[model samples]
Target: MSDAEVWTFNVDDYAAKLQCPTLIIHGERSDGFEAAAQHVFRKVPAQNKKLIIVDGVFHTRFYDDPLVIEPTATEVAKWFKDNVK
Candidate 1:
């Protein structure tokens, strides 16, 4: 099998082992793995985990659009500040 195919194993077991704070960000309009992201979020054992779904944005917009990136950046910065220390 290809390397990517070989890596396509179940990660729920690995996610359950996470002990550090985790922040999961998804786009509300994303046609990607948003549902899978939610599924993993439910399985994560971290007490300091957070999930944020940005409204009115699609996947990949967060990297280029200022309207999307601004708020997303704010949320990420706040999350790091609140959780990392």
Candidate 2:
């Protein structure tokens, strides 16, 4: 089995079982999470689903964005405040 296979199994069994609204945020410059996040979003069935791809950001931008980390932080905060129960 390869990394892809292992991740596929986990996503299929566990990630797919989430039963609530979901918000997926990714960076345009990210490589690691770009595909995984999309795959999870496609597999998981949610009432309200949102996929936010921040332009000009890398994989680590979530932690330390260049232009403005505060904007990303604010977006996530707002999303959770509005969506999560």
Candidate 2 — which pairs collide?
Answer: none
The CA-based lDDT of model 1 is what?
0.88
The superposed Cα distance between candidate 1 and the true structure at residue 49, in angstroms, equals: 0.6
What lDDT tens digits, residue by residue, belong to model 1 across residues 1-85? 6889669967798789998999989987898677888999999999999989887779899889998899899999999998998
**Candidate 1 Cα errors over 4 Å, as ranges:** 1-9
* Displacement of the residue 51 alpha carbon in candidate 1, Å: 0.3
Q: Which stretches of candidate 2 lie over 4 Å from their true place?
A: 1-9, 66-68
lDDT of 2 at 1: 84
- 1-85: candidate 2 lDDT, tens digit per residue: 8988876666656657777877788887786677777887788777688888888788776776546578877887999999887
**Candidate 1 has what TM-score?**
0.83
RMSD of 1: 2.5
